[model samples]
Target: MTTRIDTRFAELAHKGRAALVTFLMAGDPDPATSLDIVKAMPAAGADVIELGMPFTDPMADGPAIQAAGLRALGAGMTLKKTLDLVRAFRAGDDTTPIVLMGYFNPIYVYGVDRFLVDAKAAGVDGLIVVDLPPEEDAELCLPALAAGVDFVRLATPTTDDKRLPAVLKNTAGFVYYVSITGITGTATPDFGRVAAAVARIKRHTRLPVAVGFGVRTAEHAAAVAQGADGVVVGSALIDVLKATLGADGQASAGTVPAVARLVGELAAGVRSARRAAE
Candidate 1:
C-alpha cells in the first residue's frame, strides 16, 4: 500500500526537489509549545516530520537530541502522549507524513499490536526504531509493515555491499543513510563520500534514500540533497530549540519560531539541490 511517506516522496520527485525531513522531540518543554512548533513546520517548509518518542535511554542520539528527549520525558511525555501529539497534529494537517522515531523498548512495553493500531489511527505514517535490526524483524519491523506503517531502516557508512541487501530487505518508506559513523550531529560527512554512498545504496533498493547525521545548516542540507532523495535534520534543530529555551529549560517565546526558521532555510537549501547539480 502507498503510505503518506511514499506519496510525499513521489510528490517531491515530481516537483524535482529533495524532501526536507525535520525532527523534534514530542512534548519537549511542554506539550502545547511542542505542538505549536510541529504545527508551524509544514508552513516553514518541512516536507516530513519525525516526532521523537522520548525514551530514558536513546543510545543512537547525540547530546542535543539526548537533552531534548530528557526535556520531553521530564515534561511527562510518554509513548501514548507522543501518539496523542501526532493525533493532535493530524487534526489540522493530514498530508504531512509523521514518523515516530526512537527505540523499540517503549513499543514493546506499550504492546506492539495496540501501539500499531493506535499509531495508524493517530495518522502516523512511519517508524524509525534505531535499536531494532533485520534479524529481529519479527519483533517490530515485519509487524509494522503488516500494519501498513512504513518501517524506515538506517544504513551507515559501515554498511558494506554484503550488508546493504539485508538492510534494505524489508525497509519501507525510505532508507535513512547515516552520513557519519557516530551518533547524531557529532560530525560532518564528506559530501563526496555521501553522494557515492547514496548512489551505492540506490543500486541496492528502489526506495528513496535520506541522509542524516551531522546535517546542521542549509548549506549542509543542500550539499547532501544533491544526491539524497531527502535530507534529515535533527540534532541541529534540537540545539536550536534548546538554545531558545528559558533559564528553567522551558520553552521561551523564541523556541517555535527559531526552529521553524531553520527548517525554512534547510528546505530552501534542499530545493536548490537540483539547480546546483545542473
Candidate 2:
C-alpha cells in the first residue's frame, strides 16, 4: 500500500530534496493550541508530522519533550484526545502524513485493536512506537503494518549491522535514525558520522532514512539533509514553544509564529541541502 508517508518521500525524491519531519507532543500547553501548531506545520514546510502520544513515562524523551507531555497530561490530555487531535487536523488537511509517536503503554491500555481502527479512521498515516522493538512485532508492529499504517522504526548509533536487519525488517514509512546517543535536544551530532550512519543503513534497507536528535538549527538540518532522506526537529521546536509560553505556561501570541518561523528556516536549510552538498 502506498501510504501518505511513502508518497511524500517519493515526492521529495522527485524534487531532489530531503524531507523536514517535525515532532510535537499532542495537547502540549493545551489541546486546542496543540492542534493549531500541528495544522500550521505543513504550510511551514514540514513534509511529515510526528504527533507524540503523551505517556507518563517517556523513557527515551529528553527533558523538554518530557515536560511537554506533562503539560499535556496536566491539562487533561488522553489517548482519545490525541486521536481526536489527529481527526481534527485531518478535517482540513489530508496530504501531510501524521505519525503517532511515543511509548507503548498508552496504546496498550487503550487497546491496540480499537486504537488502530480509530487512528486509521482519524486519517493517521503512520506510527512511531519507540518502545516496541522488532522482537515484539506481533505485539504492535505487525498489527500496525497489517492495519495499513506505516510503522516507522528508530535506529541509533548503537544499532550495529547485526541488528540493522531486524530494525528494518518491518519498518515502513521511513527509517528514523537517531543521530545522537542520548535523549532528544541534547548535544550536537557529528555530521560526518551521521552521513556514514545513514549510508550504512541504506545498504541494509531501501527505506528512506531520516536523521533526528540534536537537530536544533537550520545549519544542522542542512548538513544532515546532505546524506539523509529526511531531517527531524523536535526538542528545538519544544524549546521554542516553551520560550514563547506566558508566565502561566500557556500559549502566548508568539508561540505559533515562533515555531513556524523556525520551521521555515529549517525548511529553507533542508531545501538548499542538495545544492550545499554539490
Candidate 3:
C-alpha cells in the first residue's frame, strides 16, 4: 500500500518533522499562474501540496476559500484541468507529494472510478473529501485503495471518543484534524485544545495527524506543529493569492513567487519548531 504521498512525506516524520500541506484553488486568476503556484511550493519548503479541487457548493470552506473557488470556476477550471495541473507539476519535480482536497459531488459527477484512474495517472498521492465521513467510505475509498491511493480522513473535535476508532479504521494515508470546531479560514484554533485532541487521536491510530483550518502565521504554524504531524494552511494562503491578484481583476506576475515565499517561510517555522521539540 505504498502511495505517492507516503513515499515523499512519511519520511519527514522520522526526522522529527511534519509536512506543510498548503491548499490553493488552481486557476483562481488563471491556470498557468496556479500551476506556477503549485511548483513554487517545494521551492518554499512544502513537503506535500493539497491542490484544492474547487466545487460550486463548498460547504466546509470559509469566505476566502469559497471566493477563491468561485474565481477558479469562472476561469473555466474543471476537475480534469485540476488533475492536469498536478500532472504538469510532476513533470518538473517528483518528490513533493500532491493531494486533491474537495467535496464528493464533483468526483461523483466525474465518476468515482474514472476520477481515481485519472488522479493516479496525474501522480496524486491522496484525497481529502470534505463530505465523505467514515460510515460511507465505500463510495470512493475502496476504489481509491485499489488505485494505489490513500483515503485520508478528517477528524474534528466533535468526532469524539465513542466514534474515533471507526473513523480511524479505513484511513490509510493520514488523519487531518480540523483544529477548531468550525469551517476552514474563519478559525482561531485553540492550540492547547488541539494538542490534546491530537494526543487522543494518537491513542486510536498510528497514522500521522495533520492539523488545519485557521493556521495563518509562522508562529501559529510553530505552535500547531507541537502536536501535529503536519500543519495545513488554506484561507491565509488564499488571502495572499487574492492580494497577489491585482486590483483590476487580473493575475499579477508576482503572485506565484510571493505565495511560495510565504508558505516556505511557514514551513520553516514548523521545521524549526520540530527541531526545538527534539
Candidate 4:
C-alpha cells in the first residue's frame, strides 16, 4: 500500500535530500488562476502539493492562511471546487502528490463517505484534517485510509513522549511536525530544536516527518532539511501570493510567477541542504 506520498519520500531519500512541500489555498482569488498556480508548482520544484480546502473558520490556521481561505471562499472556493482543482491538475501531471490540507468542518459537511470517493476519483493522494484527532479515527482517518488516501497527522512541539504514540497511531502519509507551538508564521523555528524534534518523532514511527509552521524562507527550509525528511511551506507562500495580488484584491499577472519563483528557491535550499550538512 505504498501511496504517492510514500513513494515521493522514498525517492527523496534515495537522492539523499529533503522534500519541498508547498501549500496553496484552493481557489484563492479565483479557481482558474489558482489552478494555474498549482499547475506551475511541480515545474517550480515543489515535490508535494498541499491543496488547502477553504473553510469559513480555520481555527488552526494563522492570519495569512486565514485570510487566504477567506479570499478563496469569497471567490467561490468550496469542497467540491477544491476536488475539481485536484482533478484538473491530475489531468496534466500525475506524479506530483496532492494532499488536501485544512480543518475538518468542510469534509464533515460534505459527508465523509462521499468526500472520500470524490477525493480519490480526483486523484488526491492524501489529507491533513487539522481538527481530527487519533481518538476520532472512525470519523475520517480510518475511512480515508480505507479508501486509499493517506491521512496525514500533525505532531506539535507539545506532543511529548507520552502522547507521541497516540499521535502516530493512525497517521499515514507523513507526520507533520509543527516547529512552533503557536499559530503559524509568527516566529522562526529554532533549527537545532527542530532537528532534535524530528529525531524524537522518528523514534516512534517510520513515517517521514515533515517540519512546518515556522518555515518561511529558503534558509529556514535548508536548516530544517538538515533533520526533517520534508519541509512544508504554507504561510510564506500565501504571503507571496498576497503580496503579488492586485489593488482590487484580485490575481494579478505577477501572482503565479512570483509564487513559482519562491518555490524554486525553496526547492534549491532543500536539495542542497544535505550537501551543506556534510
Candidate 5:
C-alpha cells in the first residue's frame, strides 16, 4: 500500500530534488498559533511535515525541542489534542504527509490499538516513536505497520552493519538517519560523513533516507540535501518559534511568520541541491 509518505518521496525523486521535512511541536506557544504555523508550512515549501507529539520527558529531544514540548504541555496539549491538531490540519491540506514524531509513553497510555485507529482517522501517515527499538517490534512497530501507519526507524552513527538489517527489517515510510550522536540540535554533522552514511544505508534498503539533527541553516540543509533523500529541520525551527514568542511564552505576532520565513529559506536550500548537482 503506497502511503502519502511514499508518494511524496516518489514525487520529489521524480522532480530530482530532496524533500524538505519540517518539524514543530503540536502546541508550542498555543494551539491556535501552532495550527497556523503548520498550515503555512507547505506554502513555505515543506514537502513533509513532522508534527511533534509533546511528551513530559522527551529523552531524544534537545533543549529547544524540550522547551517547545513543555510550552505545549503547559498549554494543555495532550495526546488527544495532538491528534486533533492533525485532524484539523487535514481538513484543509490532505496531500501533505503528516508524521507524528515523539516517544511511546503517551501511545502506550492511550492504548496502541485505539491510538492507531484514531491516528489513521486523523490522517496521520507515519510515526517516529524514538523509544521503541526493533527488538520490541510487537509492542508497537509491527502493530503500527499492520494498522497501515508507517513506523519510521532511526539509524545513528553507532548502528553498525550487523544492526542495520534489524533496524530496517520492518521500517516503513522512510529511515531517519541521525546525523549527530547526541540529542537533536546539539552539534553540527560532518557533511562528508553524512553523505557516506546515507550511501551506506541506501545499500541496505530501498527506502528513502532523511538526515536530521543539527541542521540549522539553509546552507546546512543544502549540504545534507546533496546526499540525503530528505533534509529534516526541527530544532532550528523550534528555536525560531521560541524566539518569536512573547516574554510570557505565548505566541507573538511574529511567531507564525518567523517559522514560515525560515522554512522557506531552508526549502530553497534543499531545492538548490539538485540544481547544483545538475
Candidate 6:
C-alpha cells in the first residue's frame, strides 16, 4: 500500500532536497484567510504543511500559538471546520502534503475512526498529536495507520536511547525531533545538541527526521538542517504571523507576504547549509 506522506516525502529525499514544514492555526481570524495562507506556503518552498488544530489548552505552545488557538476558537473553528480547510486546500493542490498538528482530545472527541475517515477524505496525510506517547499508540495510532495517515512521532532531546526504538516503531511520515524540551516559539537553539539528538534517532530508524521547537530564523534553520532530513520552523513563523496579524490574528499589512517570504528564505538557508557541507 502506498502511504500518502511517505511517498510524497520520498520524492524529496531521493532528490536530496531539504523539506520545509510550516505550522499555522486552522482558522486564525477566519477559515478563508487561513486557507489562503496554507495555499500560499507551497509556492513559497514548503514541502509539507503542518495545519495546527487549535486547542484551548495548548500546553506545548508558547504565547503566539496559544493566542492563535484562542483566535481560531473564537472564530468558531471546530474540528469539522479544520478538516474543511484541508479539503479546501486539497481542492487547489493535491500533491503538497498536509499534516494535522494538535492534541488527541479533539481527535478522540471526534471519534478516531470517524476522524480518520474525514481527514483522509479532506486530503490530510498525517497527524502530530503532541501528547500521544508511544506506549499509548494503540488508542489512535493503529486506526491512523490503517486509514493511510502517518502517525508522526515527536522525539525530544530528552528521549533516552533505550526508548528511541519504541518511539520510532511503526512511525511513518517523519520523526519530529524537538530541538528543545520546552514549548514552541522560544528562541535560538544550540545545534550541537540538536545534531547529537538527530544522530541518536537515526541510529534506530530510517525515517526522515525534522527538528523543531525554538527555530526562528534562516540562520537557525541552516544550522540544524545541515544534519537533518528536514527543518520544522514553528514558533518563529507563528511569531511573524502574530506580529503581522496582531492580537486579532489577522494578517497585518504585508504580513501574509512576509510570512511566505520568510518560509522561502529559511528553505533557501537549508539549501545553503547543504552546499557548505559539500
How does each model score on TM-score? 0.98, 0.98, 0.96, 0.97, 0.98, 0.95
Off by over 4 Å in 4: 275-278
Per-residue alpha-carbon lDDT of model 5 for 28-74, expressed as tens digits?
88899999999999999999999999999999889999999999999
Candidate RMSDs in order: 1.4, 1.5, 1.4, 1.6, 1.3, 1.9
- Which model, 2 or 5, shows the larger TM-score? 5
TM-score of 6: 0.95
The runs of at least 3 residues in candidate 1 whose Cα sits more than 4 Å from the true structure, single-residue gaps closed, are 275-278
Model 1: residue 256 alpha-carbon error in angstroms: 0.9
Which pairs of residues collide in model 1?
none
lDDT of 3 by residue, 1-278 (tens): 77767665557766877778888887777788899888888878887789888899999889999999888988899999998999999899877778899999999999999999998889888998999997788899878888888988999989989999988888877899998888888968889999999999999987888999999998999898877888999888899889977776578878887798789789888987774222
- Give per-residue CA lDDT, model 4, range 165-270, as digits (tens): 9999989999999998888777888889989999999999999999999898999999998888999999999999999998878999999999999999999899
Runs of candidate 2 exceeding 4 Å displacement: 275-278
Q: Is candidate 1 or 3 superior in lDDT?
A: 1
Clash list (residue pairs), candidate 5: none
lDDT of each: 0.93, 0.93, 0.86, 0.92, 0.94, 0.84
In angstroms, how far off is 55's CA in candidate 4?
Answer: 0.9
Model 6 segments more than 4 A misplaced? 246-249, 275-278
Q: Which pairs clash inside model 6?
A: 244-252
Model 5: residue 231 alpha-carbon error in angstroms? 0.4
* Best-performing candidate as measured by lDDT: 5
lDDT, model 4: 0.92
lDDT of 2 by residue, 225-278 (tens): 989999999999999999999887899989999999999999999998873321
